[model samples]
Target: MLVEGIKSRPVYHGIAADPRARRHIFVLEGEGARALLEQEPSLTPAILASTEILYVARGSAGEGHVEALSALGADVAWTAPTVETLLFRLKAMLAVAHMGTRLYISGTEGFIGKAMQVALDQGMDYSTIPTEHRGSLARRVQCVHCKGVTEDVATTPFTCSHCGLSLLVRDHYSRRLGAFQGVCIDAEEPGVRPEPEALFL
Candidate 1:
């Protein structure tokens, strides 16, 4: 979820859990993965066949689901993996992945975008990859002043971790920067401050 919520953002259509896909890659992040499995019941059997399930969990949140999916004869792996590692692995997989492969992804907005970027780099089209977004409303904010960026920012009017200045998170997102722009909130009027509003609350 982002500021205006999932509906306002680009939507991802999910592949039904049926075993229609010759090769299936499932990327599930966080506890919300359970919902995905439940929604697409056929996905379970697909996982048992040629599906590769990549699950990223925070702490113990993904443990139970991972176990259940694994027990059902699905090849499931879990982690709170770094973007570099995930991207590297995805690149390696894409190098050998074929045309009939289907990608089912679900996670926070940033995670989905990061994964989609990798998929696009590998020449995978939107029709081959269906996505479902879940979880928190955090922003990956980029600081224009120091050319530094931050992720998982819970709200606007936050201080920049890189530049140590109060910044206001903007609605605009830069795919090249991999974050939304966060400009100095009071740059226009030195002493003037706007009333704070809780975003996505």
Candidate 2:
């Protein structure tokens, strides 16, 4: 989420040397990812010093990114237990729109796409600005016992139906299911059980 009413500065002599210009940039990191913002390392220190540097954490990675941003001297806030539900995503979009700042979204294509749509709906005029994208770790769950993909795992715990193996949700599974898979667990097996810890590459 970005702070509203941020102004964009112009580059001069191949450098953005203006120090008085205050810009609010929002960074969106995936479930287990972090935004370094190091490519523009020169601007990083200033970005950290800005009054409104908003970072949106959607998954397991949200906490870590928030911590890192704080270390950089950013005024940070974390929205936890996130918009895990579909309805929550809509609410989040509304909240983001009301914030009223130039949005700079960075994350998986799917996440960025949905957020951009909401920004557009709010009449933010982000049509000309290109969105920054980053890759996210795939969502995966381990099922040592079963190998079949079924659609009835949610009502029941994800366990191996055939061998009673516990299921563990791993970030690698994101590759198979796509970026948004972890947003919600649609199904699971009978014996598969969720892992206590989640890993993000």
Candidate 3:
């Protein structure tokens, strides 16, 4: 149980726990992540004041969330992380291992997978802070065209009825599906390839 009186108001338990967090940085992504952060104004500022925060905006199309965060006085450093950037961030996180830093990530499944792999490669203890615990919805990938969001379906076909222009779905299943016997028309790339049904599993 944690309690704090700030400006004569009792602080939430989550806020009280921020000081105990050893991680010097928190990574944020996805739309849900931004919404949650917006809801908890105190926690964001508290976390920033106590430690550093890394904002990964890969796959996010707009700057609204980033702008709002900056307005909140969050000391965030923004970066568009590629596969190579992922490796670099991982290395940086591991270099501070003795400090017992924690990482908070919110993004598409692909981004999450890469981030988790990096954390595991560095031997860092990784945990998913529930939306309730962190006061945010779990991360999700939204279709670039339809805006359909979910974690159940990893692949999003980008032929949108609205725009009719082929939009690229970040972390599209074809990239993860690899080579298979069945046929697949890649959203990011033109052309069809044999993709096995069992290969998806």
Best-performing candidate as measured by lDDT: 1
RMSD of each: 3.7, 13.0, 13.7
lDDT of candidate 2 over 27-54, digit per residue (tens): 4555322444443355566555552433
Task: Candidate 1: count the clashes.
Answer: 2
TM accuracy, model 1: 0.78
C-alpha lDDT of residue 101 in model 2: 37
Give the local distance difference test score of model 3: 0.42
TM-score of 2: 0.43
User: Which prediction has more favorable TM-score, 1 or 2?
Assistant: 1
- How does each model score on lDDT? 0.67, 0.41, 0.42
Q: lDDT (0-100) at residue 164 of candidate 2?
A: 46
Off by over 4 Å in 1: 1-8, 12-19, 44-47, 59-63, 75-84, 126-128
lDDT of 2 at 113: 46
TM-score of 3: 0.49
- Residue lDDT tens for model 3, 114-175: 55556666666534332112222222333444444333222333333343443333322322
lDDT (tens digit, per residue) of candidate 1 on 69-149 = 555566545443655576677777888998677777777767777777788877777556777767776767789999888
Query: Cα deviation of 152 in candidate 2 (Å)?
Result: 17
Q: Rank the candidates by TM-score, best first.
A: 1, 3, 2
